[model samples]
Target: MAKRPGLGRGLDALLSSAGKKQEGEEAERDLKQVPIEQIRRGKYQPRIHIRPEALQELADSIRAQGLVQPVVLRPVDDGYELIAGERRWRAAQMAGLHEIPAVIRDIPDQAAAAMALIENIQREDLNAMEEAQAIHRLIEEFGLTHQQAAEAVGRSRTAVSNLLRLLDLEEAVKAMVDEGQLEMGHARALLALKGEQQVEAARQVVKKALSVRQTEALVKRLQAGADKPGKKPAAARNPDVLRLEEDLSERIGAPVRIDYDRRGKGRLVIEYNSLDELDGILERIR
Candidate 1:
């Protein structure tokens, strides 16, 4: 006992010092250094789309105030991959920044996809098409189920399903959406039709500058016509359908379509290009 010579006290001192060093090491590890050029866009990005005007505005903001928040990134082979704040990154580039501050993470591709989708959805940065695409990517790329993706994006599985349905529209219709001419509601209405009918209805809604109701009515008419025998309604088969759809599509910034049957059963199809449009439709329906 006498020979112990305060060994316990010495050990206690050593342990306390080790604890402090460990804490200091952890704090140092938490510090991040991110390179600007190394920050590249992720393969499974959250934002499926962006508006030029919005980007321009963001550029202006970055030019004036600088990026308020640093972007998040993960290490990759060629460069640091973006995790969030894509808009900010794009704007930073526009603002002529050479290097950007970022927090480095070790997230897996699936986790990154999930995080990005959630970030975009929470910020309302993604349009309907973009959101749909993100959800699709999460499912396809990350092997997430529709329910899992929906949970990540804080949307219902049905809502995710409907968005995916929008992708089935004609390229022209999808182009209208990407261009911000047609909304998702307009697209949904158009989806009621098959092949050429979808395109035809989309044309009418745009040209006629039809209201959502009008578009829905036209879609209903076309659906009914399809169900009934004989020729379709004049409105459904109207030559002006395309022009009308274009006009309305341009006016409302959403795709529009009119559906009519020879039996006079008619419905107008209004396609929404974005989640905002879908939200508006939901509000109206509610």
Candidate 2:
């Protein structure tokens, strides 16, 4: 079998070994021409939409150059269930293809979902909301963790966590993210706000078409004004902040203070017990 263009190394390795049977069966990923009507949508498919323009462009390509890659499938009772290449299947249908080439596999349900998620994620086809929901499915529906899912999809744990954070947005706010009216940064900044303030802030963000930096500023300004008098500020416990302090303290061989308000107004104070420690800290910073 040939490696498809634009397919990442991780997914390439996965698909290359996808259909070889475990112990019970000797089934291989033998390419077969399957009737389009017999193929059903993947049970674990998280991708909800393939843009019409993109599909049409794909269809045109399929018409002119033929489907360069065969869709992957697993056998069902009467037909095959799609494992990957749903976009190709949809585009082939658009190109008026009655039957398409496929490779039949006999993998289990969890593997099916993992492949689907990995493919979409690697291809960058899913929108932010869809991607986050898919990652959530990997953790919740498919019994993987943020760490495991991160490893599976070739992303950092922090990246997966950030993506998952988009799900915490209000339904309407999430919808805006889905439609690309708001980006992940915008959505993330909004997470700091809550209730009607959150909703109204989202509205203003959309109305003003604010940049992410501007959105963050808006959140900060709102938070500053919203604080009541005599309310004790919560200590900043951002992991990044703590991590930085730890790193600096280790370098300087002294205690480090990362002083910041809840509003992120602050300074870094490195406490050196000796002149040698102070010189070391300054050298490290340099």
Candidate 3:
């Protein structure tokens, strides 16, 4: 029948596609009041945590006004599987509704997953960690490239990359993010550290309730103090010199070292990874 819309065409196209009847498909595209017990949660559903209070609030709303939007579902062995609107489904169950309105369609696993990710992202329902994990699954399970994943979610490649980087965080730190104690920005800042330092820094961020900017500064200061093997302790260096080194390194996009003798005679060394980087640094200096 008609070609299924590409993931790059975005959520609207996908949702619209779900509404259209495809040739040779047994299911018709229409809203049906499906029994709550017959519709099970989808394997592709990306959301992990549903706040009790929020679900209660939604349940109250559904009780007062009814479900404004129908959840999308795909046919399965004995029951239908949720394709999107899991929040609505959960809230309906909580509201003690025997049946919920849903749009039944027959779609593949990948489309169902992409639709779920797009719906949650568009609704701003997922926390940073959940969103990251969803995006990551889109890549790993579907073999979509970074750019393709970004397009599927209607986000920039850099945004997708940043979210994926959150997955690199220590599990404890990721929990903090998932729990909303730390924001995405704070998590990204924490990525600058590794090992125990990252864990401790995450604790400090939550305990102190540090803002994103403050967390970034803390990461910089921590990096300055972190002593590596074969290197002098940065704590011994003048704090002013350390700050200068960090500032220069940030501005030049390279590692910078500042060494000063007691008489104030010293050198500012900028490290580069490549000849092109060296040329860029020289250009900046000029």
Candidate 4:
């Protein structure tokens, strides 16, 4: 047969050379794979929150792919300690893998925790509460300042500050986010309230589908009540309370209030912008 112009000696020679080089590299390749049991869970894992649904999805992926990448770990007193890939390891166990691949390295506990936290944050794999907890752990456990932790996570100080503030929200509201019923915006809106008011506002937010601005307006209304004379302690009132006359005022759609005397005895003044609100209050009392 006649030699093909493109597929003759030159092409054959090039393919043979490339194949030999690949084989040589493969022969030199060294990857140490360890058993699943040999690698234990890390003592300082960064992930504070793991959604059960997410874990189930990870388990499914593990079943399909059989762990494509080895988990990173360090040698410990027991066997090996995981430095990262905790979720993968957990899912692998759920997937019933006999042995998982892991790469062992020597690193300090603090460094390992920081690495794990930074990895998760960069991946955006953590929820708001978990992110806040991670940042808090970096500050509390690792002795890092808020600014330092913010820098470590590649977030602005205000962003970190605001996220941490969410931690102060009612647990019910936090559960809402955990259950994926509410977003951070909703939580932020509720955070503007205090104590039971936060829970109440959260309920209203969900029930009324209130926008953030509307929620904020409700919060301001509640705050204005606190600012009114005789509504709050007499010690805290400003001159504006007097300028407004009556213990409280009601503009269109404004909140109604009833102020009592400091001695706990006085006329019960009811201020309402509309007849509907007046009737609504009366109906509730009756």
Candidate 5:
């Protein structure tokens, strides 16, 4: 076993000893330096794709100051297997190092997977979809429920649930989120629609570079305008009056529009379908 650098305080804590140990046995595993080829990739990599540019940057750093923290690994038939720090392992190879530092732990499969996912989230290396899939796995494969998953990841139940809902978005929209074209806010707003409508809204969000607020307004207008299916509401010069039209339409069960000119004046127009509906509005108002 060879001495290795500490992983600052936070990541070191994430890897603290956790399994049953014999009486009087050492709880901490000794850090070791092992041949890079002998260390196999982990059972599952939460981050499937590593950006070459980022790996090269880390490699350059390793070449200069060396790997600040050793990768965590476990024993396998051939040699050792990665438990965490896939990025560091890949970068070391890019740095053309023959052997890298490691700490070998005997972690249970479920716990090992959880550790990998948690480390990736901490590094902000996982995209939204990858995060969701990892969380889903911790629930399904490990028989963990919502509360358990939340606790495992140190996130609020609501945050976890909201992130899971992102999976419900159309794959196209999700791809946008994963690729960083549309952020979580945009995905959340797009959730207001469904099927092709939601997908189209996501496209508009990216194409127009609309703010979250603007996207919400667009969704509302689209939904409210769906009564006539394809009819476009005429533009109202006064936005304040336009909002009034929406409010009146919702309140009165009819399409309403307000037209206004220069100085805060307008005509409120309400359309009614049947005589009975007209009578209903008259009775409600009077």
Candidate 6:
């Protein structure tokens, strides 16, 4: 497949190039002055939380230095819809600006949605739940296959599948993930249970501040109890080994498992769902 233009560029370049045009076989970004009041929040924006203090800080910066980067917008029936830089738009409004600098593009709905999702992913702005919801929206609303959606966001198919799996989480548990109460690994482990069991396990995980490894163990115990009537509980792992697993998992951004014995001979394992994630883990180790 041919590589898409501006896919590898960082957020700023992507935002600028979102409105790129070809004139005599040369491409250039054109900036415009758009009325602040006429711009509307984008339908595909992935970020759900914008901190008040951070918004104020950006507003202050705009008030002093002006908006250094222009926002990306596309034409809509009522007015221009924001394609990227919702933060800058909100801050410009907070700074009492009548007009904001913007790059106007005439793109279809799928293009706009993909651009919005790409911008947030590049910026690392969306939490796991928000990102999953955004990816799910992109796939469902546009009828894009997992591979197509993965290509749109520059993610592996496995990575995209894992994110979509997060959506299967019960709404209350999903809220916890969205609110930063649970990490991705914790949520993934909780997926082993269903209904009230899953929700209750999530609460217990949060209330006790359990690590990912511990959360997995909790899920296992719960599953065992529900599945087997008289099965013996597994022996507890050494606390030190458990801590090491948690620490390694935290450092590598993937699940880690360790096996230990009386002779101090054991194995260490790190689990990754996709090649991209495996690459990330390897990089972190190096």
**Model 4 local distance difference test score:** 0.64
- The sequence of per-residue lDDT tens digits that candidate 6 reaches over residues 1-286 is 2223543333334335544533332322468888998999999888898778889999999999999999998889998999899999999999999999988777667668778877876566578888888887766665555556677687866566667768878999999999989998899888768999999999999999999878998987886674357777777668888788878866766657787689999899876654555655666688
| Consecutive 10-residue window with the lowest summed lDDT within model 2 | 1-10
CA-RMSD of model 3 = 7.5
For 1-286, candidate 5 gives per-residue lDDT tens digits of 1222332233233335444431233544777788999998888667866778888999999989888899988777898888789999999998999999888777666557767777775567677777887787666665554545677688765456556768878989988988878877678667767899888888888999999768867776666674246787644345666577667755764556666667858687766533434654565466
Quality of model 2 by C-alpha lDDT:
0.75
Q: How does residue 142 of candidate 4 score in lDDT?
A: 54
TM-scores of all predicted structures: 0.65, 0.72, 0.73, 0.61, 0.69, 0.69
Model 2 Cα displacement at 134 (Å)?
0.6
How high is the lDDT of residue 12 in model 3?
Answer: 43
The candidate with the higher lDDT, 1 or 3, is 3
Q: Which 10-residue window in model 4 sums to the lowest lDDT?
A: 246-255
What digit string (tens of lDDT, one per residue) describes model 4 on residues 29-105?
A: 33456678887777777566677888899899989978887787777887888877888888898898878877655
Using alpha carbons, what is the TM-score of model 4?
0.61
Candidate 2, number of clashes: 0
Each model's number of backbone clashes? Answer: 58, 0, 0, 0, 0, 0
lDDT of 2 by residue, 1-286 (tens): 1223332344334444554454345445557899999999998888886789999999999988888899988889988999889899999999999999998778777668778878778677788899998888776754554556777788865567668767878888988889888988888778877777777888889999999867866875677664446666543357787678767655644446587887989998754333433444465567
All candidates' lDDT scores? 0.68, 0.75, 0.78, 0.64, 0.71, 0.78
Best by the TM-score measure: 3
Of the two candidates 1 and 6, the one with more favorable TM-score, higher being better, is: 6
Q: Which stretches of candidate 5 lie over 4 Å from their true place?
A: 1-18, 22-28, 226-229, 234-286
TM-score: model 6 vs. ground truth: 0.69
**Deviating ranges (above 4 Å) for candidate 4:** 1-31, 207-211, 226-286
